[model samples]
Target: MLTIPKELPAGFEAYGRSTDFTPDNLPARLQAAHSTKAGTWGLLHVLEGKILYQLEAPFEGEQLAAAGEKIVIESEVPHRVKFVERGRFFVEFYRKAELTPG
Candidate 1:
């Protein structure tokens, strides 16, 4: 596993851990554009080579996630990855914090 940063954006908390994957073993659907259910977010970690993270709706663009780099996936948003070269990476899921009564 790559050394992912411990700091997370405000209001976000990692719901799961120990997620590890690589291009050679990645599922076909994950390699394609797909969105998580509402309120769920994804964090892609690049441990080697380079990969492209693309947005399709609500926003549109492509980002390079190379070694030591990570790409954030907004909730209910369309996105995909195109392998640029031999690479290794993993994804971790996160969710927003629920507000407490004021």
Candidate 2:
């Protein structure tokens, strides 16, 4: 049950960035991700094992996000270390400036 975000507003496109932290020494695919600093928004999905989502500071929140579950967050938010997972996961970055008014 993979859930993807709805389409962005007019003139906005999904900008994606991906990095594989799966190790060569291990049989598991483990990766961790942090959002971009350019005032972007993103969604992270775990295509294999489970993941943990953590928020820093006054946010004081944490959740055990699972495979096929998508988490959305703003880049500028104080939250950090959003996800730590094992297996395939990808992120798509979005920004308000990318959207053009009709």
Candidate 3:
């Protein structure tokens, strides 16, 4: 069984998130191999059912995430997801937290 990383890289903070998506409502871009922008990361949170997460090229592998679980996405890594069962999930984007001058 493939193990999914549960934690995001240190210093990164959540910047945004996608609306919850189900099998019938998932976008084609997400169903096909794609990647996060440079310096950005993503966390796929499964809210219901299960999803198949697949990585491409240098990170080639796959894993299944069920309700209440999350999969960490590395920056610039090609990856995609498919519904394994009736599922609902969303991707939360992250980036290094900018230091603010006090």
Candidate 4:
């Protein structure tokens, strides 16, 4: 099932830069549905409006992330995010373990 992390896990560090998505231009993978790295995490912060985040099977459900709210994505978890209204958001990738941890 989809879950909400109260805070970031220990040792988790930003792997890449934060990404912004708007109603006008959204990534194809994020739109079509995709998963993150095996040890990669994602934090979606909604700056304005609302977003509809969906998870794949085994944890099939939709989450509403509004302004001032955020969602923590598990590593390798199949999921996708969508814009509920005209707004913007950013996703910060993290690596809780190590960059090359297996």
Choose the strongest candidate by TM-score: 3
Best of the two (2, 4) by lDDT: 4
Candidate 3 global TM-score: 0.91
Give the deviation of candidate 3 from the true structure as CA RMSD.
2.3
Reference-based TM-score, model 4 = 0.83
lDDT by residue (tens digit), candidate 1, 1-102 = 122233546798888643566667777887677888888877888888888887765566778778898887777777778778788888788998888899
Runs with alpha carbons beyond 4 Å of true place in candidate 1: 1-9, 98-102
Top lDDT model: 3
Candidate 4's residue-wise lDDT over 30-99, tens digit each?
8767988778888889999999888887777778989999888877778888888889999888886565
Give the alpha-carbon lDDT of every model.
Answer: 0.75, 0.52, 0.89, 0.81
Lowest lDDT 10-residue stretch of candidate 2 = 22-31
Q: What stretches of model 2 exceed 4 Å from their correct place? A: 1-12, 21-35, 80-85, 97-102
TM-score, model 1 to reference: 0.78
- lDDT (tens digit, per residue) of candidate 3 on 1-102: 333466888999999999999988999998898998999999999999999999876665888989998989888878889998997999999999999999
Alpha-carbon error at 51 in model 4, in Å? 0.5
lDDT, model 1, position 39: 86
Give the runs in model 3 whose Cα sits over 4 Å from its true position: 1-4
> What would the TM-scores of all predictions be?
0.78, 0.59, 0.91, 0.83
Report the C-alpha lDDT of model 2 over 2-84, residue by residue, as the tens digit: 22233443444566666632323222322233335765777665666655655554455555666776666555544443235
